[model samples]
Target: MITHTTQSVSKANIFLTCTDEKYYRDELIVEKNTVIRMISGEMKIILPDITYVIGAGDTIFFPRNDLAKVWKTGKDGRPYKSVAIYLTPEAMQQYAIKHHIKPIHPSPRTGIKCMAAHPLLDSLFNSLVPYFNLKNELPESLAEAKVDEAISILKLIDQEVFNTISNVEEPGKINLAEFMEKNFMFNMPMDKFGYLTGRSLTTFKRDFKKAFYTSPQKWLTQKRLALAHYQITEKKRRPVDVYLEVGFENLSHFSYAFKKQYGYAPSSI
Candidate 1:
């Protein structure tokens, strides 16, 4: 089986991720403001309307609580490798306080933001490489300092990053249909979907029924299957390739569902 692994270079949330698989994909919800620098190979990040492909030497930032689908690919006989630094809320808050920075108005939603080439950002990521060889975790104080330095650099380079850190607002209720349609492929739990869209579990179900005329689970399955069908027949993708991309958990369930929906096996397509 293809595998992906993450090793913490610092106990305070710096990580080194590696994968030898040619293509590995997964969906995630970012729990903290994360900065990732590609060390080798490439990565593709899929959002609702845009797809970003970054190769070695590129860096990208993901805002806290954002949902994203990612594909990592080994290239040129080299395994995919990247370093990620997670900026925790406590660290951000402490930095804001120390710098006397006040919370600002929340900015409009934007997906992942790519940083332009900058020596400081590049140096910060590269400097962490030696930590990977350390047998012991980097001290928490030093790790926090690294995180603070990253926040400081972000503040100087990207105003959006600074605003994201300063804004303390939670997600507000959004249009259920639009949000669900855009994010149905994420394969998240009902409660997570609700929370992301700023609704309670009860409200999400009721609103989903009203908007789609079906339960959330049913709507998601049908939507995922429909997309998978298109990919399989029109795009000439195989069942295994289409399954995870369209939100199904496993090949067996996807095949069963596809056959049920079309009265034929997807492999026959």
Candidate 2:
């Protein structure tokens, strides 16, 4: 589902897409720093400076001024499906000032990329992604509240990523570890991931294990099944509905994955 809303004063647009499917290769012209969150599935972001193949748990912050190409790659070297949130800078700045935090500025380094797998940040991203997608007019107080939460998460990420940059080396070309954590919803296609990175599939898998301490496929499946569990328990809806809602195309596949992850049938829940 894609949702769109605009702020009257700033005329900033917020676009939201929540899907259990893959997206096609495309580019967005955003006038502000756009936060892309992977609610489910995998996404391959091809930026001018770097290409990021992010899984469910991962996110990429594309500053407003940059132009980038994005592709949705699926498992089996195919384009994986994904959902995303897009926000304009003016709206984001308003959210920031209301929360008493400085808005994100262009990094001193051109094309600087920051990646982290903080749980709070993930939650805040998840919450706001939908909020901005749904509302027409945001009251000043509500906007401030959302801004505060977002800022808190951003500050934590800043401290964790920037303060410790020296200790981590170049932080790796791709934040595979963080991607896996944030995108625990499906298995990433090693071949596709490699293709994006200009690496052989074999080499990509090897490097992914070395960097993330896990195989890409295994990590992705675990995340997807876990997300399925969460959605089932939290939604209070029918089991079959949850299945399709979370991106599984068929009941058999969904049931198999659910039992594999939780050792129970969907009906058990």
Candidate 3:
């Protein structure tokens, strides 16, 4: 089993995440625009259309309201370590107003944004490493200052990323079928799916029925199970490996549902 740990600097949105195991994998529903600096080891981000790998000394950005599968791995006997700073809407708005910043042009990219090496980025993240050893929590004001400094450095180094982070547009109504088809494997609540696809709960269910000809719950389960079945049988993956990756919360439930759907347990495959 993987031993995962995270340390934070008080009320600041910054985080230091580590894992002792050789590899750790999980899913994320990013709630805020986030920048991560890889300190050691490597991280691979799997998106719907692409995958991004970040190594030590690499800086990458994840936009808000995106679903991704992240795989982290240790290297050369060292644990995986990274510093992640979430860019809050309030902070972005405040910085924009204070700096007289406006969106230059909308970015068409949906995948991870990678930036070239810069001294300011390196200096900021290096200074944060020692805070992990502190006994007392850092003050909120100091933490916010660090975040603000990062925002300023970003504006100077990468304007495209600066614009992407500064803009906080709500998701507009998009094609429900195309969206759901790509994102059905993520384990989110019905309402959250609705919100991300720009619909209310009532509208989500109604539109889901029209698009899938079935209830949301039923369609999601069937699709997840079908994908799991393919992975287990065709790809020769184990039941344990396939269950969580397919959105089932537990092994027993996944086994029960797999048996019900195919008239046999997943392990039998």
lDDT by residue (55-157, candidate 3, tens digit) is 9999998888889888888877777888888898889888878888775555664456887999999999998888878777877878888899999998899
| Model 1 ranges with Cα > 4 A deviation | 4-10
Better of 1 and 3 by TM-score: 1
C-alpha TM-score for every candidate: 0.92, 0.42, 0.87
Location of the lowest summed lDDT over 10 successive residues in candidate 2: 162-171
The TM-score ranking, best first, is 1, 3, 2
Write the number of the candidate with greater TM-score, choosing between 2 and 3: 3
Q: Candidate 3 — which pairs collide?
A: none
Candidate 3 wrongly placed segments (more than 4 Å): 2-11, 21-25, 103-109
Return whichever of 2 and 3 wins on lDDT: 3
Alpha carbon lDDT at 147, candidate 3:
93
TM-score of 1: 0.92
- Look at candidate 3 and tell me the lDDT of residue 129: 80
lDDT of each prediction vs. the true structure?
0.85, 0.52, 0.85
